[model samples]
Target: MTSSSKTLGEFFDSFECEAFRLETLDDYSKSGNVDAYHAFLAGQPQPSDYNAGWVEELRSHTRAGKRVHRVHILSRPLTDYLSFELGWGYRKNSTGGEEFFILDITDKPNPLAGVPDFWCFDSASVVVMNYDETGKYVGSALLEPERVVEFTGYRDTALAEAEPFVEWWAKYGT
Candidate 1:
């Protein structure tokens, strides 16, 4: 397995029996072209079982006092599809006294080909992203946000670009 996968596996294993809340795109329900945006905003029941293992793992980590945040970027078409079919929205989990945020990155324009960058999760005080020498997303790193910001000026850009997602999350996510 790749090192990233191994690291994630190790993290999960560390909290095997802990209890944490589950939040993901899968947590939302989907129908035809109408994502139950209202339902999601209202915190309705989950309608599907996809990503169950991932959900469990997240819950476990949070239970073990680890903050868990995730981001998924979708193509515009897929984003529309999700918006229409499922009530995909943002949701926050307060576990272990930590808040985890999730956002959809499909709408934002991609950075330049050689722009090295990272995302800083403020709640966790952790920076995570995949970067390469060519400025491509090649691997994920877990580090301090200040380091990423000081090194790449990515934090401000990320926060600005993420505003829409954050707004949507606040409105639609539980």
Candidate 2:
């Protein structure tokens, strides 16, 4: 696409084949679900409609033979927000055919150290996620085409050291 017309929304709408995300934060409580996170902290049950929009979007993509998956690099003793994200968000998002994996670096060095979180679409385009220290979503930067090789390497290395979320959660879920 031309620089004049490039947009994240357009990228999401146009990408084919697959979408991969890397999440390395312990808490994204301030991103989009402020109320839901508070409810989780306050002992409220997860609302049925939580994340309905994203779920439907995933369904639309997967239903069309596209893949949406993520690898979350996290450790044991998960934070409360991580708990909500895994037990509720991941679990619910799976219903729409999104895949989750966990790269537990609790006992070892991070192989993908210093790599910022990003989403690589169809192995071609990459949009790097930008966040504040408090885990707030600031914005995303679309990298130049020449840098896809670097991001693809990160994705491959992450997947190599990760396990499916269902299996890992079963063995170590809080």
Candidate 1: which stretches are off by over 4 Å? 1-8, 11-47, 71-156, 164-166, 169-174
Clashes (backbone N, CA, C under 3 Å), per candidate, total 9, 0
Q: Which ranges of candidate 2 are over 4 A from the true structure?
A: 1-4
Please give the TM-score that candidate 1 achieves against the real structure.
Answer: 0.37
Structural similarity to truth (TM-score) of each candidate: 0.37, 0.95
lDDT of each: 0.38, 0.91
List clashing residue pairs in candidate 2. Answer: none
Q: State the local distance difference test value for candidate 1.
A: 0.38
